[model samples]
Target chain A: GAGVSQTPSNKVTEKGKYVELRCDPISGHTALYWYRQSLGQGPEFLIYFQGTGAADDSGLPNDRFFAVRPEGSVSTLKIQRTERGDSAVYLCASSLNRDTGELFFGEGSRLTVL
Target chain B: AQSVTQLDSQVPVFEEAPVELRCNYSSSVSVYLFWYVQYPNQGLQLLLKYLSGSTLVKGINGFEAEFNKSQTSFHLRKPSVHISDTAEYFCAVSDMSGGGNKLTFGTGTQLKVEL
Candidate 1:
């Protein structure tokens, strides 16, 4: 079975640039989640999608962050005018559903804002 | 809102020695507790969880955690640890409040097993 995967294992960009991160969830999984983890810290929830809609986006730090799950199978997290503070490992996860209680995580996309 | 706290930032133990990574969470309602491990250059992997029914939850790779309601803690413990267990262990709590499946994670405790 294929597990969750994120593209561009690593990304480096300058401040004030726009960036898009992609996530591919497990087969038949209906829920997807995104998180950010800075060095020396645990992952923090950024957003989550249930089916084709975002179930929650409160974890997003500010209006500069937005995410979408158009086909319900894939999700894209977009950041506008990124800053050095946004540099971190962006992680994606999937489960049968949000209530499943177990989450399979992607290897994570390490984003470095130079 | 829910939050988690891990007591130790790093714990170094000898191989075959007992070890415990302490975690405490604060939430207004009942919640689910989980332990995740992150190997170097990798993402977090679920080790164990406690939703209901059992106070002691066993997870993969010979690890377990106990959920304590009165103390507001879900501490991960292993009777004996191996060098292969060296990794960053995170304790998290997820409570679906206001349709938030967001997991509140602790700062993480790095477990180093010395030979």
Candidate 2:
């Protein structure tokens, strides 16, 4: 794709269940980011990956939330023991590099925990 | 550390009227400012950015913003707005100390353009 791509545009699951969201960044982009946006709020940083390694994961809310990019192109966000409060739009973005400061975002995966 | 403040939660404007979305930031070190727009059921799109040199930056869809160092603000403006411009606007800041990668965003401002 010419732009960032995300899977599972909408997901509905019961509380305590697990879920996984996927993101495919633009080709050749070396930096990928994940953010969460709750209702009526702006997107909040979650994690960032530089190539196959996660250079920064401080924005992750808790241990339940984890992300990985094995090949430095495709990334996945895994949530364990999801709660109602975990419902939000998980956004993925990619850039040529962190220094460029210009990120291309995907449509986002809207997760609803019931 | 860096933070952004968008005082107005919502702004209602008539079509063809000028609109201004205010954004302010606080940072201990140098910072990069950005404005992004999110339409219903869509991802955020960059409106403009203030990195260096030019305080006044122009972006797509005839939108522009000015960077005020003293006031620590980057207000988005358009001479005339269209109904299609109605969307949620967000102000974000990134500190230079962090390589300007992670962005801290304000709550947001909903711009409602009516006929």
Candidate 3:
């Protein structure tokens, strides 16, 4: 079975530019989540989606970060104004549902804001 | 809010030697505990979890963790570690208050198994 898949294994962009990272969850998965991992740190939660609606977006760093899962399958994390501080590995994860608690994670999209 | 802390930033052990990675969490309500491992250039993988029942929870790749509610700790331990066990280990906590599935992760402990 296919695990969570993230596009553009690596991306480098200029500061103050806009960027979009995509995630493809496992087939039949109803829950999705986004996280960011900085150097020497663990993955930090960013947002969570249950079906097509976002259940929690409190982890998002600021207003510049937003995510959407309109069809309940694929999700997109958009950064309005990328900053050098935004450089990190963006990770996506999914579960059968929120209750199971076990989340399958994707290889991740490494974003480098220069 | 809940938070996790992995006491050691790195742990180096010889092959076939015992090792333990300490983790502590703070939360006002009931919470679930988990341990995740990440090999170089790979995604995080679940090693074990402690939701309820007994304190000792066994997980993949010959690992186990003891959940001590009183001490607010869930430390991972392995009797004998292999060179393959070299990786970063993260401890996370999720409580009932928040979207039960949202996990708060620790900085991570790098396990370097030396031969």
Candidate 4:
């Protein structure tokens, strides 16, 4: 794709179930990021990956929230034992590198917990 | 840790009127500032950023922002807004350390441009 792409534009899951959202970043982008946006709120950072390594994951809300970017080009955010409060629009973004400061964001995956 | 604050939750303006969205940040270290816009049912798009050099930065769609270090502010402005400019505006900040990768965003300010 010419820009960052996210899969499952909308996801509906039951409480206590698990879900995984995927992100495909722009080609050659070495930095990938994950964020969550609640209704009427701005996106909150969850994690950031530099190549195949997660350079920052401090923003992850809890142990249940995990993300992986094994190939550095594609990433996945996995949530275990999801709660109703965990529902939000999961956003993915990528940049040429952290130094550039401009990030290209995906359309986002809206996760609804029922 | 860096944080951003957007003072106004909503701003209603008539078409062709000027609009300003205020943003403030708190951080001990140097930081980079950015403004992003979100149209209805669309993903966020970068409006402008303040990385270095001149404090006043121009962006797409006739939008601009001024970075003020003393006030720790980056406010977006447009001299004349059109109805099409109605959208949500977000302010973000990132610390200079570690390439300032992670961004802290404000709640957002909704700009309602009416006829």
Candidates 1 and 3 compared: the better one by DockQ is 3
Q: Each prediction's Cα RMSD?
A: 1.4, 1.0, 1.0, 0.9
Off by over 4 Å in 1: B96-101
Please identify which of the two predictions, 1 or 3, would achieve the higher lDDT against the true structure: 3
lDDT digits (tens) for residues B24-79 of candidate 3: 99998999899999999889989999888999999999999999989999999999
Model 4, range B1-115, lDDT digits (tens) per residue?
Answer: 8889998999999999999999999998999999999898888889999999999999999999999988889999999999999999999998888686588899999999999
Q: Write the per-residue lDDT of candidate 2 for residues A20-53, one digit (tens) a residue.
A: 9999999999999999999888889999999999
**TM-scores of the models, in the order given:** 0.96, 0.97, 0.98, 0.97
lDDT of 2 by residue, B8-64 (tens): 999999999999999999998999999999998888988888889989999989999
For model 4, the docking class works out as medium
Share of the reference A-B contacts seen in candidate 1:
0.57
Considering only N, C-alpha and C atoms within 3 Å, which residue pairs clash in candidate 1? Answer: none
| C-alpha positional error of residue A87 in candidate 2 after TM-score superposition, expressed in Å | 0.8
lDDT digits (tens) for residues A1-114 of candidate 1: 488989879999999999999999999999899999999888999888889998888889999999999999999999999999999999999988577468889999999999
Score candidate 3 by DockQ.
Answer: 0.73
Model 4 TM-score, all chains together? 0.97
Give each model's whole-structure lDDT: 0.90, 0.93, 0.93, 0.93
